[model samples]
Target: MTQTLTVRRSAFTVALTLPVLATALLALPPGTAAAAAPASGSAIEWGPCAGMSGLDPRQQCGTVPVPLDHADPSGPRIDLAVSRIASGKPAARRGTLLIIPGGPGNAGLHEPSRRGRQLPQSVRDAYDVVSFDPRGTGRSAPVSCGLAHEDLAMERLRPWPAADGSIDANTATARRLADACQAGDTAVLRTMSTRNEARDIDRLRQALGERKLSAWGVSYGTYAGAVYAQMFPHRTDRWVLDSNDDPDPARVARGWLANYAVGVEDSFPDFADFAADPGNPDRLAARPGDVRPLFLALAARLDREPIPWPGANPAQLNGNVLRQTLLDSLYTKQRFPALARLIAAARDGGPLPAPNTPPDEAMQNTVAASLATICNDVDAWSGEGQAVYEKDVADSRARHPLTAGMPVNVMPCAFWDLGPSEPATRITPHGPSNVLMIQNERDVATPLAGARELRDALGDRARMVVVDSVGHAAYVDNGNACGDAKVTRFLLTGERPARDVYCAA
Candidate 1:
């Protein structure tokens, strides 16, 4: 199914609520909180935001200066674009709540106003909602590799292997992208690791005059939040990590990339069931049992003979493109029609769906930042060249064909220009018991298994609320009131479920 080709950005929208601090801290003197204030500095000089849409007029924008490399606190600094909507009831305000976005590259400057709108009025009145564009994204100092239009497309950017599980194209593409990024702005690119992002958040906190800040982090933001909690436990007030990631420091980004294999397998059945429902206007099969084989056959046929698709960067409806579309459409139920229609069009030899075309610059910035963080956060890439990747791809394809071995395929990280400045921070149980994790039963990006890894790592410091729902997020977008209510209650009242619990859909 050909759709308007938008610059492929890898991010999902999610809402969040937070937990209260350690019980011991609750006993502190009412007048003073130990980690409640940072070194005093000039107050934020708020001004009208320009070019950003869907934000309240009252939403104010500003910037904070942070060391480009936290190692040198006095070294060169960079500006981080931040936005905030002050508490409507200052007397009732609990403190500041930082909203962290999903993608390692996604901009969250509008989140304070966007997601804030969905939050309960009590939660809103209790905190100053805030978010920002991470180091190399959005209104902050952005970076780009100036990748070719084709390279920037979602299908190509995801490293999907050619149909027979061959990774020849993936390897060459990885090298091309890695070289371009290395040749671009090396300094800024090198500073774009999860660790640096966490540090940047700390800097933002200090600049905001909050010694400790509460946070609601989603997707990749969950990882960044975990690192922050691990590195600066005392600096955290309340933390809500939604759709968690595995905190395996050794496999940092590599594990996340590879997790697509399990994630797709875990979530595809939901899509299949949807596609085969006779009542579905866009149903693709007569029965749920027939959906999988039908999709596999159609994908194979496209692999053998692609249809010409004008206006798209690659200009053809190839097998990998269809596969990429399938992966994307599974993210949420609303996108199911796009996939079903694409399949119907492809099967019936009709015109492909129009793709959503985002500006080229937006694509460049997102792709560059994603690569920088994944590559700089850890040394997971084997650097063993094409032959090894080929073997891994073949093996993965045999086991999980739905993913076409792309999850295990080579990426630019194998050829990254720089290594992690420091090892990825290991998440542990040493932090205060201030974290509450909420996850959907099936998530395409961050799977439940990975969420479990994080939960295990946090041990007694956290409680997880598992939602009996499909798709990525457990909050706003996913229609699970049971899950939403639990999360909302916890954030609003500092009340967590006594133990791990499940919320039925």
Candidate 2:
């Protein structure tokens, strides 16, 4: 990944350690639907949660009924799964702040209970924290491709080119998967664009009767929050976008997909350093000199002669399969062992161990959801033919050898037939002036370059903090004191950094 020293960009209130379950939440009956909130300002109707079980009486869970297509609110609709732990401290209660997670596939409904528990008291005290599962994810109106059991494999789901760069199988897989999505609900699948998601957010805001929303959006959710802030600026207050992405209007998710190659390049060094550590029992190399070469050699060898990995999702370990495994494992330092173990075994000419595989029922759900959201969002493969990507895969394989042709290669999106419902919405300076950005200096998925682009796109409307660190995300990923303090302070108080500051790693 290229390190961009960027200046093109221009780019939260709260204070307190919020209580476990806000007293404000306890005031409302549990399990009330998000839609049930009356239009009355400052006073929301409440009821017991319908699906919540085993929770303390304070926790509330319910569904938010939203138009499948905002253009046709009276038509088909779906529910967004939601949960809330009202502000624990009634004294500092400001308003609700929604936590939007990444993955376009990540489930946030449980976050008010999981990640929310970690908020500083000031932040927790002031905000009635709420989170939800976006449409087609988690407990919402879920959609599955009904993919074959074998296709659920991650290596297969993401297109990894053949050893010699032939993309025949990739084309087939792309076509097969895209066909499944097209055959599903032609109406709602088309409704999965971020614009619709933004409209759904405003609807939620209107239902809650809040003049403004305090939001924490991370990764893919940053784009969602940015869109919400842009489309309904008056309704937003104290917006923080962490681990941002490139908000390129022309490509949208296409650009995001392509960014994966550079994302790996930016993040792999940390993994390299971890594997080079002297104390690592599963260390692949004694000296730092041996790490890259050893990884490259193992991948190339797997390309020339594959290994059998029975019990893994795909059941057989092929070249691209090993490459894909390497890519996913690079996301965290703790997972370095999975890569090292594979390399050490390959180097010693020993039998590669059988990978553990659990029941793939949930795996099916994950795969389907990933596709449904990505495909539903944008038209990735179009006039951009495979020729450009073929060269890219071959060139990237030569340059980064460890990841082989996996990241830059063709994916199911290459064959997707659906076009974006509307041109990708360009996030502009048109939104409210109250937005803060928190970024890790080195992020894998949402790289600094893209974040700079997003910052520039937002113009003078936002401020940013670059945490001196290397990882996929900053918040919850790095424990930097300054980074956390800056984030916590912003979330609790309406204050922001005097100027954009860079905290040392």
Candidate 3:
């Protein structure tokens, strides 16, 4: 089966009921009381990880049992897959540094070996790096909605409207996905929320016997890290949030999705520069300014006449598919050439590139978890009717033609049956002044605008480092030496710029 073109880094709802508000309040206390503490004498048995290739040999895997429903501690339990690579210089170890993965759906089981090893040696030596697959993901008793193959495509997942700008198909898709998830096993889906993920982190901290956790959270992980900081203020040491999202408590996931319009506009110029350079083989235009128009025209042309692409999801390269490809490619400059090539091929009637899709089973798991987290995070989405969505989509398309209203279009959350179990945790400046945010000036997935929102929300509790680079996830990935140096110093010596600092490309 052709795999869906998933948006790995990129990717809520609802108001708080009285009971939900109380649940949020009860979780404010620091330490074990704030989280569902694991049962006594139930520690993860560290051993070799199965089936993960290229993992660092030093990384060991384990599982910690967290309540399937945190509200009922003695109820059914699910095993959270955890991984760790002990400090290279254990004698100099200060504490644990949790490597939080993004996507809300992305697994962190391999992060201890992948991103963990990428850290500076001094930073690595200072802490035992650890990560985990949040509940309902990876080996943590995974859940799937069993969505059909076509529904898993990027254009559908991102809710791109029809070529005519009508959102009828998109709305239908939203309702269908919502129904599928509702009919599937919802036990684990109900438990998948950012708040619960924070609670899960605390549980892991307890299992590891750490009093506090210093963490590096990127992309969606940044939002997760902020929530953790808010819910357990005293338990976080040095915090690093990269490529942040807007943390409007009322909007939550909704705001993050809508921000893509701004993010793409911010990041596209860099790709235009690369794609229009005279020296580039895949140059799209004679001038950087022309690249945008060329792309737009090509997309419009494809909308009217899609080229058949055998063995690919949806089996053709249409305007929305091209648009989705552009969105995915803009995540990093390293991917710019691929986008350029695809655009050039589609325009010239060349053979289509092979589709990159994950196994059906993996796609199902990721989509299910992602939908559950965003939909179950809050009830804010349920109130927006189809007419409201149509107006929003039209407005979004008018303002941002590149994204074609997909960012603000209807999603499964709009039709989700299960409302939030608890209120979305509002991140505030009330936490310890220990956060350091690093953001790319032009990140498509998590734009600077949203990062600033998060930075502002944290108030005096955080300082931000703005890197004059394009792409997602600053600090060692798509970041300058100045920004990397700043983050590394903070991790190693607990030093931050006295205030927000900017780094030139």
Which candidate leads in TM-score? 3
lDDT of 2 by residue, 176-260 (tens): 7777766776555546657667777777776666767888898888998887766666666778899998988766776776677
Each candidate's root-mean-square deviation in Å? 6.8, 9.5, 5.8
TM-score of each: 0.91, 0.86, 0.92
Residue 69 error, candidate 1, Å: 1.6
lDDT of candidate 3 over 347-396, digit per residue (tens): 89888788776677888989998999998887777665567777888899
Candidate 3 residue 469 Cα shift, in angstroms, is 0.5
- The TM-score measured for candidate 2 stands at 0.86
lDDT of 3 at 188: 85
lDDT of each: 0.80, 0.69, 0.83
Q: By TM-score, rank the candidates, best first.
A: 3, 1, 2
The regions of model 2 sitting more than 4 angstroms off are 1-58, 349-359
Model 3 residue 69 distance off true place after TM-score fit, in angstroms: 1.7
Q: Per-residue error at 407 for model 2, in Å?
A: 3.1
- For every model in order, what is the number of clashing pairs? 7, 25, 7
Model 3 Cα shift for residue 466 (angstroms): 0.2
